[model samples]
Target: MLRVAVDRDGGVTLDDVADATREIDRVLEESDVMGELPFTLEVTSRGVDRPLTLPRHWRRNEDRLVKITLVEGGEVTGRIVASTEESATLDVDGDTREVLYADVAKALVQIEFNRKKKQNDSEDA
Candidate 1:
């Protein structure tokens, strides 16, 4: 199976996915890269649970909660406040901490469900 991941700022649209699929199909058909190999081309969006690796990934995930595993073996949970090509600044309990991308071993977006609801309920009191 050949999986293709396409992304854009904000998000990608259906047209983008369709166009990518068509382009990929055309390339595969024209080229002998597959060498008559039977393959399934699957184009899909990047999953929220995907690990953050590139600077673009970090930038796209700004304002989202993420659990970062440091190369030194410690883990940190924070919201991505800002990101640059070399590093990202995370807001950990209102304190901003800068983490270099090279120091990050793994980073995954944390899914939040009721946190917003709880926060709003407290504000209404």
Candidate 2:
């Protein structure tokens, strides 16, 4: 089975996966990269469990909760308020903390099953 992990700034949608799969299938068929052997091609998004390593990854996860491990030795859990190429700003317990990418050993997005959605003005009325 061939598995392809797709990622985007905001997130990966079903349409994106479908488009990628079609393109990949076309390329493989044209190039005959897989020879005569039949195989399954599975395309999916980089799951929430995937570690945030790049600036883009951090940017993509903005507004999401994350658990970060510092290189110096410690952990922090907070919501990603903002991120730049060099660092990310997190809201931890109502306090904002800026953490440089160089200081981050690992970071993973946390899953919230019952997260409250931001209510729109129309919804408030």
Which is the leading candidate under lDDT?
Answer: 2
Off by over 4 Å in 1: 13-41, 115-125
lDDT of 1 at 24: 99
**Cα lDDT, model 1, residue 68:** 94
- Give the per-residue lDDT digits (tens) of candidate 1, residues 79-121: 9989999999999998999999999999999998755643545
- How many backbone clashes can be found in candidate 2? 0
lDDT of 2 by residue, 53-81 (tens): 99999988998999999999999999999
What is the C-alpha local distance difference test score of each model?
Answer: 0.88, 0.92
State residue 92's C-alpha deviation in candidate 1, in Å.
Answer: 0.5
Clash count of each predicted structure: 0, 0
